[model samples]
Target chain A: MAKILVVDDSNFQRNQILRAIKDDGYEIFTAENGKIGFDLFEEHSPDCILTDLNMPELDGLGLLKLIREKNTDVPVIVLSSDTQELTAEKCKNLGATDFMNKPFKKDQLKAVLEKVFQ
Target chain B: MILTPDQEDAIKEFINIGAGHAAGALSELTESHVKLSIPAIKVVKLADLEKEDDSFTKEISSSVRINFKGFTDGTAALVFPPASALKLVSLVSDEEFGTPDMDSVQAGILTEIGNIILNHILGAIGNIFQQHLEYNVANYVEGEIIKLIEPDDSTPDLVIMIIDTQFNLKDLEITGDVVIFFKLGSLTKFVEAVENVLS
Candidate 1:
């Protein structure tokens, strides 16, 4: 199983993603915010990273930039509930592998993960 | 800025119905009983929001805030104490809680849950008003307090609803607010709609 890192400020959101991926048998790691997420990224070097866009401390965009600066190849997905089109486009420009809107469906998440892992 | 008595009553009724829909959505998703209470609804000037010293974060061990916009110009925040959030994760994942990565997974789940509940509530509002409303995808954030205000330089009156409730799955207590900011023109329509409904 590939190792995965999930980062978001909310414990509830992080847990939901963890539960979805755990059945896949992947080694999972989590962080509460961008700063912690960045720290864990260095610690685990996970196969994939899923993060929220708006967070206290450091936001997803900032974390993505930091991760990109360190390593460009790892898949990073931007997950957010923000409806503004500009934000989604900005995430892509920043080198995010993909983007998913909040309140994502189980199948939708699984599909994205499968694509990333593939 | 003035709402007739009938208009106020209609707005309250509409919000209550929307809250019920949100509770139902949560129940279906978690397969648990959801209890929601509508404590009050207030319309405040954007400037006045700063005066309300509400600390949902201090009361809860940990909290999650998700925001959605588009169909309605507002934010729907879901705040869960740390213990409550963890318990929810455990129930959904069916994994013994040993601190499995908190950032990615929990944020994802909370984002989705927030999206569903917010959508349900907003969708209910749309239905009541006979208007089609679409929402931006939901996202998760953490803080002591999460507020949705009109952008700087834009002064718009907003309707704020405080909802206190608990989810049956592990008895997680969630308290949050749904904020809707109406444009000057839409405000008129809203008042008219409320009047029509109540009349």
Candidate 2:
């Protein structure tokens, strides 16, 4: 089973993502912000990470850079409401595996996870 | 409202950046081309919102409202006339609905859209200005603007920055207003940020 870490500031958005993937059998760790998320990444060494871009303390880009320092192979998918092509490009340049815009469908998220795990 | 002409222009430039990014997010979500027209912004008392725009105050509308406070304190809302809200939800869900009334499911979808768009706009402002903001959960409400956005009791004379944003998606044009009602004291801080950016 793949261990996945999910990080976001909004409880509602986190719950929505959890509800979408709860039945998928992935062992999940959750954090409310990127700092806690990076700490969880260090402890659990999850196979993949899904994170929101804007957060207090530490942001998604910051977390991605932190994760890359420790492990470059683990897939880090960035979820953001920022639709700027430059944002996606910046994530790519920073080693993010994928970028999905927020308000994404459940199936869309699930499919992306499936592709990542496969 | 005490801003100089240069300061006001700077504020509008910030708002346009935020709205442009939000429009891009909407376009991606709906898989359509979305263009944002230059936003028309005005400052008015909360009581005078009806006098400012008929589409927002007079028509039946659906809105998602979020309250946030940090470097600046205020309420922000994405207001859509009923038909436009219904059309947008339909476009997202690939469903056909004859009525302008949105069901729970449709409202949920609209709330999500609003959350994304509003977040993008606010997030841009926060990032560009380096302000830390904490947001209340997004709320979906329907009906008149007065009912949707209640005036703050503590600040009886709340000033509102009404940003009229028009989203042009493919052939259909949808109009929504991003209304940010700044608390009395906080407006100064926001203006200061604008001036700081200028200097």
Candidate 3:
């Protein structure tokens, strides 16, 4: 089973995303902030990571930027409430696999992850 | 969305855009330069759930609510005391409607004001994130502040932003509470966009 890391300061969001992808048989691990997210990433070595852009301590971008230094192969999908071209472009430049807008449907999350995994 | 310094500043600026837009609309409406600014933005829990006798929730205030959509979708309201609401009605209309309670006509005026304020804010927010948003017709509801905004499926660990804005009618203060109820799930994305601008 593929393991996925979910990082978000919002518990509600974390649960929503996790629930959307949980039934896929992927082991989902969650962190409240970037620092913990990175620590878990190092330990769990998730196949893919889904992170929220804004968080306390360290944010999703901050984590992605740091992770790129050590491991550029790990696929990271960035989720944000607002969709700004500049931000999405920057995330892509930082080696992000994809960028998604929030209030994502279950099918949307599943389809993206399926594509990434394939 | 935990009130980090960066997130806090971003939220304040976000609200500032909405406030500025609302003020602009009011200026155009009244032909007077209305001064509207948000002094503080704080994440607050629902008063009814937090305290039994919350002074903030004690007042018999009237509210005009609009459905805020795009990014973080939910309800946004401009809540004020009944007298203040009446005064606002008086400023906008040519009729003498100085009643303690908001009559149907006064309520209609309040609804229009609420729609104006919300549309301005929603437009500013939607434009900021490069998204288009549409809000439903503004609804006027009178009662406790918490009850007015609280959703049917109560959020447990719920926290909302209290945008304190001072609406001025030429040196006179129009005391109103700009309360927004968000589907917190979507705020994660909203904050994400703010961080994008910051980064």
Q: What fraction of the reference interface contacts is present in each model, in order?
A: 0.12, 0.16, 0.00
lDDT of 1 by residue, B1-199 (tens): 6666666667767767766766665665566787776665656555565566555523433433334433344455666665666666565555556773366766676566666566556556666766555444455555544333335424635544444444553475655555455544555666666666565
Could you list the CA RMSD of all candidates, in the order they appear?
Answer: 8.6, 6.4, 16.7
Backbone clashes counted, model 3 = 3
> Candidate 3 on A1-118: residue-level lDDT in tens?
8999999765556766877877799999999889999999999899999997756688888899989999569899997643345567778998999998654667888999999989
- The model with the greater TM-score, 2 or 3, is 2
lDDT of each: 0.65, 0.81, 0.74
What's the lDDT for residue A8 in model 2? Answer: 88
Better of 2 and 3 by lDDT: 2
TM-score of chain B of 2: 0.93
Instruction: Select the stronger candidate by TM-score from 1 and 2.
Output: 2
- Model 1 TM-score on a 0 to 1 scale: 0.52
Please report, as a residue range, the 10-residue window in candidate 1 chain B with the lowest summed lDDT: B57-66
> lDDT per residue, candidate 2, B1-199, as tens digits?
5567787777788888877777777776678888976556777776666576457768778999878788899888999988888888887666799776788878877877888888888877887787667666577888877665554533447777878888888688888888787877788899888777788
Q: What is the Cα-based TM-score of model 3? A: 0.59
Clashing pairs in 3: A80-B189, A81-B189, A81-B190
Per DockQ, the best of the predicted structures is: 2
lDDT of 3 at B132: 58
Pairwise TM-score winner, candidates 1 and 3: 3
